[model samples]
Every structure is written in C-alpha cells, then in structure tokens.
Target: MSSRKFSIVSGFFLQDDQVHATPATIGALPPRFGLVDDSPECWSKFKSRIAELNDNASSGTTYKVFFLGRHGQGWHNVAEAKYGTRAWDDYYSKLYGDSEMTWGPDPLLTALGVQQAETARTAWLKEIPNGMPTPQRCFASPLHRALSTWQITFASDESFPQVMRKVMILENLREEHGVHTCDMRDSRSLIERNFPPPTYGFELGFTEEDAVWQADVRETKDHIKGRAQSVLDRIFDDTEETYISITAHGGIINGILAAVGRPSYSLPTGGVLPLVIRGDDV
Candidate 1:
C-alpha cells in the first residue's frame, strides 16, 4: 500500500467513545475547546483554531478540517431494515430490488432520506453564520442517494452559502464496489443529466460507464480502505483547501475515518463527522 499522508488530530473534538452512541450528532462536542485555550464552543472559534493550526504547521505538514456526511436513508436501507443485515447481505443485496421498490443501478433518497437531508440543510444554515468555516471545497460520491443528499443539503435552498451549492463527484468516494446492487452506480451520462455541471463536476478522466463495480465481486474492507486512502491522496495533493465537505455512503465514510486514524464510528443516515487532520510527507 502507498504511504499515508494524513492522520487525525484528536482531543479537539468529542470523537472518542462519545461519538459511538446511537443518534449522535456533531453538536455533541464539548463547549470548552482545547484547540484554542479557554475558547468557547462556537463556529467562529473553531474556524480560528483551524487557521491557527495551519499557520503554525511545520514544513511539509498541513492541517485540514473535513466534514464527512453520510447520505440519508435510501430504499436499500429500507430493504435492509426490513430483511435484516444477514439476509440482506446473503440473499437480497445482489438483486435489483424487492417487489415494492427499486434499489438497483443507483437508488434515490426515500421520503425519510429527503427529510434527513433537509435536517442537514437546516443545521448548516444555522451554523454557517455562527462562524462555521464554510467548506472551501465540496465533493460527493456519484451514487444517486449521495448526489441527491448533497443537492438537498446544500443547493436546494437559495439561502444557503453559495460555496456549498457546488460539488465535484468523485468515483473513489463511492461505497464499497460490487455484489450489492445499491453500491453499483449508474451511467455517467445519466448522472450528468440528473446532476448537471457548474453545480456538479466530475473528477478528471471519470468514465461514462461504471468501471470499478463487478456484479460477482464484493470489495473487501481493506480494499475499501485503500480506495479511501487514494481519494484522500488525490484531494490533499491536488488542492490546498483547508475546509472540505464530502457527501458519501456509510462504507465510504467508515473507510475515510479509518484512513485518517479515527475510531470506527457508525455514522447514521444524514450524520455529519468533522475531523481535524494533519497531513505530512511520508
């Protein structure tokens, strides 16, 4: 495996066992901050702390803040919930869908999913003015649910910060490849038609057809982590954005957390995780 370029800087946030609780949210962070001594728990202070980390970073080292959001509930989630994980994984996940709903080749958000995205929108709208460092860059997985969540959570409302409205679609940001039909993305042409450019751009050299997925294969956890590492390498190498937002799947998010040396916390649908990461030369 290629050398890692980033590691999580803990103690600044409540990212330990506290985040592992059911229905946990980013707001669960402690009010008294350590990033800046005696600083109050507010967005402005958080932004200032990030700036300080960057300004003081040593040569060949850089610090960035990433807001990783998991896409809201999809039909696949519903199916899994209905069937239970073992059955879904062993039998149902490979199929196009159940009799009631379609989840194959990319499933869109369910009603609950849309509402979950709206909740995220409300949270961002409420926080941005409170000194939330607006994400300098935004990215999303190409799957329909993630794309839709990105749109609804950032661009649907005109009142949101303009910077949050646009996002680049990264294939590497997608869920673990193959086996499960829900993890299989649709054609690039269809994705473009649904999420057009200016608002949604593709990574350079992105193929028109789904390339990584295989109907008979399921990517192992280690492979997913490697893919996540490659995507992070791309981002850190190609851009200097200090604050970034990525909308993706639970598996992808897990891989990202792992790549950055964070604990294996299960982010719920529409859940957001913020990481203060320090990147350095290997």
Candidate 2:
C-alpha cells in the first residue's frame, strides 16, 4: 500500500466484524419505532428489482430507501489534516507515541462537525419537509463521533414519524477499528447512559459487549466488502421498514455501496444520500 493508503489502513478507525447474517438467514429484524411487519406483497416488491410493480410507487411503498450518512467531522479528521499522508504513515506512532493515551479515545465531534449535522437537517427540511425520506429505522456506528452525529442530525426534527426516532447502535457500522485510537468506543454502559431512549435506543436483542470488537483487529478493504454485503443482506432481509438511515463512517459507507454493485459515493460530513435497495440486489 502507498503511504496514504497505509495511513488509512493503520490510522483510520474501522469495524471489521464479519457478520454472517443475511436477509434470508437473519431470523428477524429488530423492531423499529416506525416499521410495519412485512407482507407478502412487500417481499414480492423486494424481489423484482429491475421492474417496478408500479412505476409511480412512492419510495416508501416499493423501494427500500436507505439514507446512508457519514458522521460529522471529528477530532481525528483534524489529526489527519495535520500531516501529509506519508508523514502520518511513518511518524504517526512515533510522534503521537500511543494512539489512545496520546490523542485519546473516541473523540467527539468538533464544532464543524456539529455544523455539518445542522446543515443536513436544514437541507432535509427544505427538500423533504414532509419527511418523505425520513428513516423509519436508524442504525449508527457505535463510536462516539458517529453516535454524536446521529444525535445532531435529528436533534430538532419533529418531522420523523414516531417510528423513525429510535436509533440502533451497530458494531458492524463502526469505522475500521484497531488502527485509530479515536475509533475506540466507550463501554456498553456508557452508550446506554449517553444515548438513551426516546431519542436513541439500542436494538432489544443486541448485546452491550461485542465479541467482534473484543477481537482487536484491523481488517483489509476486501474483508470490509464481505462485511458490507452482510450488512446489506441483513437489512433487506430482516426489515419491512420502507425508509432507513445509517449514520456511519466514510469507508464503511463505501463498503455498503460496493456490496450492492453501486459506484462508490463520496459523502461529506453529516451528508445523507438516499439509496433504494431491492431484494434482487442481494
């Protein structure tokens, strides 16, 4: 890998868990505040990706709308900005000494990051005032920056129908981990305390401690590919939610897009892009 690539591979936070669950195999999608149980028609609509059963069908009716978002800028982004890619690859450890102790763990969003989140909300208000693209089910990276972005994006929005408000924290959605100290998330207890119910809540059956995180390993992009495919597979298979949002990192967002055969998207901080997933995509 080039030095720049090395910087990303070694310094960027990534979550590399290989989720085996697919939509077909995942037993059930956890309940979301806004999702309805799947119907046979919904499955039928899901299977026919190339042909729209109804040409004029709204996004909420036929397409599995995904609003994939990147979290706002964090302190880590600032750190990366301080050095050239080559410098970072060579001197990241020596200059910083230790990642966690030197820079700290799970850095929160910077002021600009907060602004980015606000911008997303404002744009949504202007464009989709009725919450047409608002997510019924939301998933976010477990890291602090991502969680903070998820909070800020919806901070003032009363537009989300009651069901779209709940947020699920997914370890799989985390950025590449073990490479960056800023990627380290707080313990499950801290998450439950910080992002509580009403605004953000955990999936009922998901665990607080994750074995995948405990593994303490960094994953290659190819591995991320598998992870992305699994995430997409499970999301489409498990839920009947018409609209969904994922608050994640840039790399992971690319993974998701790549998994589904879409061109990679460049999402800015707090950026939200809607993607329609069909059953056949998996």
Q: Which candidate number would show the highest TM-score if scored against the true structure?
A: 1
lDDT of 1 at 39: 35
lDDT of each: 0.81, 0.60
Error of 1 at 188 (Å): 0.6
State the lDDT of candidate 2 residue by residue for 1-282, as single tens digits.
Answer: 001000011110011112321222221121121122244343233324323532554443334667777888887676666665566545552243335423436777888989988776665565443223456788888888888887776755776465666687777788765555565667788887888766766655666664453233566787776777667666665776666889899888888766665555555666665455544420
- For model 2, the run of ten residues with the poorest summed lDDT: 1-10
**Candidate 1 versus the native: TM-score?**
0.91
Model 1 stretches astray by more than 4 angstroms: 1-3, 16-41
- The candidate that wins on lDDT is 1
Off by more than 4 A, model 2:
1-62, 89-103, 204-210, 213-217
Global lDDT of model 1 = 0.81
Instruction: State how far residue 57 of model 2 sits from its true place (Å).
Output: 12
